[model samples]
Target: MSKALLVHPDDSVATLVEPVAAGESVTFAAQVVTALTDVPSGHKVAIRVISAGDPVVKFGFPIGTARTDIAVGAHVHTHNLATALDGTLDYRFTPSVPFVREAVAETATFQGYVRSDGRVGTRNEIWVLPTVGCVARTATRIAALADAAHGGAVDGVHAFTHPFGCSQLGDDLAGTRSILAALACHPNAGGVVIVGLGCESNQIAALLAEIPEARRSAIRTLSTQLAGDEIDEGVALVAELVALAKAERTTVGVDKLVLGVKCGGSDGLSGLTANPLVGRMSEAVVDAGGSVLLTEIPEMFGAERLLMDRAADEVVFDRTVKMVNDFKRYFLDHGEPVSENPSPGNLAGGITTLEEKSLGAVQKAGRAIVSDVIPYGGQVSRAGLTLLEAPGNDAVSCTALAAAGATAILFTTGRGTPLGFPVPTIKIASNSGLAARKPGWIDLDAGAVLEDGFDAVADDLLARLCDIASGAPTAAERNGEREIAIWKRGVTL
Candidate 1:
């Protein structure tokens, strides 16, 4: 195998695909260099001489600055590098067109359930939501019993419980209510049952008021304060909704598809393998006249410009700027720097700075022109690429994607995670080891791209996801891993 990989021609360092012992000779970029220090797999090794205080380049961008003079083949990471990003900066609208288009002309279709409201759903499932934390367990019990009793009725039953709706004031409570309302109205959910304690700050009445009138008919609400037997009552209500949801299955074109994109537990090979593979899938779906939602606002740090320049119009460009800066301000307002990322896992996996991570994370969006922007807890407003606002937390961002009407989420991870969201969350592993280690967690392996090339692997991944859209369960679904967490941006009373 090759000793290391040079991601871009301008990169000053190369990523080691395997451990390199000290004094070992390896060739990179047509030059032979001896290793000055032992570097593990996925770690960076300097391919050229870099003076102290000079930028340490990777991914063809300055990830950080060298803390000290770096010799050839020296390990380049936290000890030798530091982030150059500070607070937010001014941004301008400079549109750049994507040279390559990944969308196709022919129509691709998936089997889905069509609701009375004319929305298409990849699954026919019932979602149980608790308006207040006090009734969270109550919602879970109802879901368990309903799923057991009506196993053959629809797809499945799930309960998403969150610790909110009580003691939360202002926007925090509003955020909780809006997110719950959004999930309750998601197209994947054929039916919904919202349970409430009746006295919490988030009332069932106010929550229902936020849902569209047409969607309300498929939603059933209950108050534990009034119901004689909440569990039985909920199951009965679910039975009625099951009957409504079991109507019929129809074939829908790619235009009816909305795919959510995210990456978590990323490693050095993420951008090279899994992320870009998902990007190809994104371009394919977007080109076929479908919508793709990209969230995790804070993760867009150094790579925001790449997306901004691809904005379809000035209006979208402006909105994209506001979203990026607003998220940065949220961090500054909390006395945290905008570059507070590349967590402990990320560091161990060879990621050095937020800039480096962002550059890789945004690859999931591919080269498609961003068509629109959606606020936190908002749904997709248009087709093609749409950016959504949410923090970098995995659960929160994936939940935001699901709440925004994603039929299925394409989640790439170099370091594996078993966490799954409400809708089908397909975990694509960046390296072969992780995929082999977590067969039950990973749905597809992007590691094959190294041998089979991106086009072949991208085609395989797109077909796998299309199968998932057409009633084939993902590894997460097979493992029974469905969860939801809301973004709380307010204070508690």
Candidate 2:
């Protein structure tokens, strides 16, 4: 394997393929250079002398400015570099990439649960939803009871408990209601039992109004205050839904698949391995006439233009611009730097600035055109690629992806996490080391891309994803890490 990788010809820095000590010779961009300082694997090292305030190029774009004159072969990170990203700025829709839609093979298909409304589901399970946080435990208890009694009759019984639906105002309250409503309507839930506290601001009636009447038959409602035994009532309701579902799976086209692309605990090799590997999967899914959703708006601070340039049309380009700038405004309004991302975990994994991180994060989207832009708590409409408005937080963005109608999420991580949203989340490891160390956490070894090539591994990944879609459980699901988190951006009442 190469000692270091020069991502782009214009890059002045190269990522270390392995740790190197001072005075060690390493080849970068086909040129040998002596390491001036110790550099860790996945961290950047200056391949050329960079003057103070001069831009440090990586991935063929400027990640940030050098804090001081960086000598050739010196380590390049936060200590010698800082983000150039700040408050919102004006953007022009200069289309650089042309939209080229890949042809979908008519023969591609997967086994899925076809809903009455024509939507396809990757699972046939009973879901217990709470209209208010007050009934969260009640919902969980009911799901546990139902799972114990009727789990065999269905895929499984799961409860998505969250701490919202009350004491929230404006968008915050509406976001909670919308996300709950979306879950209630999710096709994966062959039957749904909505548990309510009877007096929360997010009333069952209001939430039901958001769902179509066509889906009402599959959804059962219960208010603890209105029932003598809410758990028994909820279980009975779920049983009836289970009977109605029959736990049957039918063949569906790849067009029915909706995938959410995400990454967490990313390390240096994330961009080179796991992310790009997932990017191939994303492109293949899109080429198969399926839809893909990508979130983490803040992480796109520097790489936003790459997505904008791939917008399907002028309208989509405009929406993409607004989504990026508005997220920046949100940070500025909160007195936080726009680059206040790349958590301690990210830095530890060899990431430096938000720009470097953003560039890597956006790779999960592949080269698909932006078909639509979804707001927080909104559902995906267009089928190609949708850019969702969401923060960089893992839980929040994963929840948003689930609420946006993704039946399964492809999550790449260098530092593993056992977090799962309502849908199945497949964790792909960026490095073989992490995969070997945490077999229970990683579902796929994307690090193999470095050795076996992306196409070879992506074919395996696509197969794995199909198996998950066809009822195979993921690591997260097997570990019982299901959860939901709504983004709260407003004050409480």
TM-score of each: 0.97, 0.97
> After best superposition, candidate 2 residue 201: deviation in angstroms?
0.9
Error of 1 at 159 (Å): 0.6
lDDT (tens digit, per residue) of candidate 1 on 1-493: 2367788999999987778899997666677778898887778999999999999888898888999999998999999999988887788888895647545523677888776766678888999999988999999999999999996888999999989899998888888988999999998888899999989999889999999998888999999999999999999999999988775668887677889999999998898789998888788888888889999888889889999999998999999999998898999999999998999999998999998899899999988889999988899868899999999899999999999999999999999999999988999999899999989999988988877999888878877877888889998888888899988887778
Residue 403 in model 1: lDDT: 95
Q: What is the RMSD, in Å, between candidate 2 and the native fold over all Cα?
A: 1.5
lDDT of 2 by residue, 1-493 (tens): 3388888999999988789998998887669888888888889889899999999998899999999999988999989999998788777777765545555334566799988878899988999999888999999998998899989989899999988888988888988999889888887889889999999989999999999899898989999999998888888999889899885688887788899999999988898899988888778788877899999999999999899888888899889889888888888898888988899989988999999999999999988888999898789887899999888889999999988899999999989998988999999999998999998988999988878988789878988988899988898888999998888888988
Point out where model 2 deviates above 4 Å.
99-107
